[model samples]
Target: MDTPSEPGQPTRLLFLGEENLADGFRLIGFEAHPNPSPAQVEQILRQLQHTHDKAFVLVDEALMREDIPQLKRVRREGGRILVMAVPSLQGPTALSSDVAERLAALFGTATLRSE
Candidate 1:
């Protein structure tokens, strides 16, 4: 498990998603911003993509549906940023299903089970 950095250190992990999801990350010590609009998410991505200390960005998959182009650009241009789409509190969306399929293909086995 990764421990939180000491005070004054640049943030390493960031979460932008539903309030409930963001709160979950906050509880784990990540810097989290809840319920940002797509535009706001884009702005934050632009600002943080170049920051040397930024490592990971966890965003709600549902939110990305509104601004996929921006997300793609960030993924393509962000040399070190690991942008991950996560399911919201409401449960899995199309993106999650796609991801699961891709992972299953990659690993040659079922990666997720449907309820």
Candidate 2:
């Protein structure tokens, strides 16, 4: 027999990190899943793509060592998802990259500053 869905269920947000982080997200009413390894992250993401209402994925930079390549492929295939690489509790924040400089060089916006 099929079961009915719950109407007020909170939307899911995947968080691949340490247990502490997971517990923190849960305190605020979010469904946080932990994955500290690349293999686990890959498997969880593949499975989550089908079930659970995942709005955004928060992957730590360390996990990116292997997960990034796989994610790039998913993006290239036009997957309708937003995977934001975030910082682990003991790691640096995302967006601290030289890609912006490279982008600026390519688009000539290096010196375009805002006041």
Compared with the true structure, all predictions reach lDDT values of: 0.71, 0.57
Tens digit of per-residue lDDT, candidate 2, span 4-48: 334575446667766777787767765576655666666666665
Once model 2 is optimally superposed onto the true structure by TM-score, how far is the C-alpha of residue 32 displaced, in angstroms?
2.1
**Deviation in Å, model 2, residue 18 alpha carbon:** 2.5
How does model 1 fare in lDDT? 0.71
* Global fold similarity of model 2 (TM-score): 0.56
> Poorest 10 consecutive residues of model 2 by lDDT?
91-100
Tell how far residue 17 is off in model 1, in angstroms. Answer: 0.7
RMSD in angstroms, all models? Answer: 6.4, 5.9
Off by over 4 Å in 1: 1-11, 50-53, 96-113
Lowest lDDT 10-residue stretch of candidate 1: 91-100
